[model samples]
Target chain A: MTAESERRTEIMDAVERLLARGGVNAVTMRAVAAEADVSLRLVQYYGSTKDQLLGATLDRLADKSVERWQARTRRQRECASPRDIVESFFDEALPTDRESRGFHRVGVSLEGLAITDPDVAGRAYQKHLKELADHLTGLLQSDDRSAPAARLLAWEVMGLAHGLGTLLMTGQLSEPEARTLITNYLERLGPQLCL
Target chain B: MTAESERRTEIMDAVERLLARGGVNAVTMRAVAAEADVSLRLVQYYGSTKDQLLGATLDRLADKSVERWQARTRRQRECASPRDIVESFFDEALPTDRESRGFHRVGVSLEGLAITDPDVAGRAYQKHLKELADHLTGLLQSDDRSAPAARLLAWEVMGLAHGLGTLLMTGQLSEPEARTLITNYLERLGPQLCL
Candidate 1:
């Protein structure tokens, strides 16, 4: 990568860390500089304003999350059934571990920003959802399921994952309990998928 | 209600409006005074600190959402099956109309607060989930289903509702699309509930 692009990536990385540690309230130009271990002038040079910096950071997060899912899908391409695909996705999406919990924390923060300020972070978040929906819809489409059915199922899974993840993160549900819920959900859905 | 409690409610109402319009960033002591047309001293008297104010607002929101769900459940008490209860929940939870959309916007912002600053708002949000779970679990426990099954299903439905609500609010899934997705999900889940 070019030196300029590398510097930009470092700055975005620092922004993500700040966002993860605390929500948007914790992010400031000075904080970014401190987190990135760079000068304030350098941070300013990389990201001109807070909104611009946040917007770019969200765009990068969207890209990274989608790419991660795509890579996971590729690895699981040889799974035996649609049910396997869905189960694998739940396994990955649930915030059981520390890293995933941090990711979900960032997501909830972004979700807040997205809903209240649709013009700023909303566009990036929506694009992220669309890309994920497109990817999951394609995965769910096979010999028996039509594209529309796949799309709905894709959304259903996405919604469940997101909600269940939130519940787990908030300490309302234990990890084992969440797994049990998913197991029952899949059992109920298995026959529908003719698995 | 007493005069003092009435004033407090009005101030909180203003906070909700600010939060709905601009997330957490828009809510300030001065802004609350302006929005509620109350004196700044009155706002301070009602809510001493920003965190205290936000915590009280979230607690109120949790109570309101749970009470709303309970009222809806009461109206649907005679529904023949668990599937009906789940369907009724989706109908109520989705942001299909303006009031629900505003409620949802408030919810997303609070969810961000809940996850990122758990000490500040997590307790109330968790209480909200627990109450909703208890209510839904009661609905699902009938002649055919056991308490364990009912509890799991309650959470699954809750999770799906929260996630799909986010998707809908964020404009990733339109209201009609969300309805269709729930319809398909119910169809798949029907026999599981033996409806």
Candidate 2:
């Protein structure tokens, strides 16, 4: 990659860290410069405006997240059962690791922003969610459910995962607690998806 | 209220208005002063720190929301079955009105804040959630399900409601669409709760 491209990635990484630690409030140009060990002028030269920086960071997150999910899906060749697909869905959604938790925190931040500010950050959040839903629908479209039905189911699971993640992060629910919750939830779907 | 007290309320009200419209970043003391048509000194006198002001506002929101839900439950009483309770739960969660939407947004903002800030804001969110769960458990804690089971069920419904609210705000789910989704969901629940 070019030097400029590498610097941009570095800046976005700093932004992600700030976002995870303190939401949007933490992502100042100076802070990014400091985090990246770069000069203020360079940060300005890269992003130019706060909105531009936010948009680029959001786009980067979208690209990276989607790519990660796609890469995971590609490693599996057996499209045999919807049961397996949905299990993987839960597995992917859970914040079982450091990277996943950071991603989830970023998601929670954008979601909070989207509620009140529907412009720079809110638009980005919708884009992320839409892409995720599309990816999930792709996974379950050929199952017993139709595309629309599959999409709705995917969204339902997404909603539960988001809520459960908040509960887990807040200590309201432990990891085991969330796992049980999801297990019982999926059990309601039964083995029909396996057919 | 005296003039000074009225001004304080005005300042806090402005903060809430800005918060509802723009999340935490919008609630600067200067912005609150401008929004309230009060002096900066007066705003600062009423709210020396942003965290304190945010805490007060969050506390008020928690009280108001719990009270609102209480009112909803009272109004919906005399309903024949748990089915009605499930339906009302979904309806109450819907961000269908401006007031309800504002409340929901504030709740989401606080929830996100709880992840990292975890000061008064996080405490308020947890307390609010607990009270709501207690209320739900009060409604669902009889007959067959044990107390723990009822509480778990309440969390499930709460998680689903929160997730669905995000979906609705993002324009992914229309009113009718949400209704259909809930209908299918409740049908899946069947008479399990009553037993």
lDDT of 2 by residue, B121-191 (tens): 77878877888778887788776877877777788888888888888887877777777778777877766
Please write out the lDDT profile of model 2 over residues A10-118, one tens digit for every residue: 8888888888777777788999899888999988998887667877788888788778766766766466366666666667776778777777777777787777777
Q: TM-score winner among the candidates?
A: 1
Can you list each candidate's DockQ? 0.84, 0.61
Q: After superposition, how far is residue A83 of candidate 2 from its true place, in Å?
A: 2.8
Q: lDDT of model 2 at residue B127?
A: 79
Give the TM-score of candidate 1 (chain A).
0.92
lDDT of 1: 0.83
Segments of candidate 2 deviating more than 4 angstroms: A74-80, A191-195, B1-11, B39-46
Cα lDDT for residue A2, candidate 1: 98
User: Fnat of the models, one by one?
Assistant: 0.94, 0.52
